[model samples]
Target: MSLSLVLLFLNFFTPQFNEAGQAKLEKMVKDRDALTAQWKASESQKSGIFGNRTKKDMIETNEWLERIIKKDNLIMDELRMIGDIETITATQTGDDYKAIAFKQEKDVQALKRAVAERDKQLKEKLSERRTFEWISLILFLISLGLGFVVYKKVIKP
Candidate 1:
């Protein structure tokens, strides 16, 4: 009975004794490795916001809007030469549109600059975090190595 019990325990725990579990464990390990690789690749491609954003995330300014307004105003002014009624209506709407568009353009340009600045700050923060992680890993490994050395010298008889 004791021998049988020992055999059962070995059969349950040993990988070779449990081929199905062993295969499953190997597949799980492989899947875990694949997932880790994918995560790393994705992280490397990220703007550091959990890889959820794109270059559009960087555009938070209205300078571009101002540019568009200036361009549209030129075209609108040119359109005025084609008709006197159009010239008057264009003048009436032009100031209001230009003013509003200018403000909006400035706001958009400012927003874009702000988002770019935010991304730069985030990049610095991530760089610091990576440095800390490396330092900690190195320290952990050194401590482990020291502990092994101390154990071998003082405890192993």
Candidate 2:
């Protein structure tokens, strides 16, 4: 029946609705029943010269109103807690992402520095090799000129 389906929905979803515990849900149901009984009793009274309600009835109604207000405040507190949890989770995730980005940037900088040092060493070695080659070429030319001078002066005489 539709009534059974409604009961099922309340049973399954009421706790999740406010994220309240089972004890809190039971307390809410008791408060709801008490308020309903008070409402029905007040409605059945005949309107008279006294305007329908005694002072005691007014006091009882005031108490029920206060109880309802307390329940609403509790629900609000639970909602605020859920919001705080979500905010914390978002902040933590953002921090983790920033850390990963920072680590990757550091790694890239380190690799760039290593490559620059390697290039500098290679350039130094290449310059040293070129100097050696120039010195060897000059020494060979000087030895050939000395050999020609010795042959003309000593061997021809």
Query: Can you give the TM-score per candidate against the true fold?
Result: 0.43, 0.60
In the range 29-59, model 1's lDDT, one tens digit per residue, is 5655665555455444546366664564334
Looking at model 1, report the run of 10 residues with the lowest lDDT sum: 56-65
Best by TM-score: 2
Report the C-alpha lDDT of model 2 over 1-157, residue by residue, as the tens digit: 5544655665576447445544565676677677667656655554445676666766666776776677667756655765665565567556666876898899999999999999999999999999999999999889988999998999998
Alpha-carbon RMSD to native, per candidate: 42.2, 11.8
lDDT, candidate 2, at 130 = 99
Model 2: clashing residue pairs?
none
Predict model 1's lDDT versus the native.
Answer: 0.62
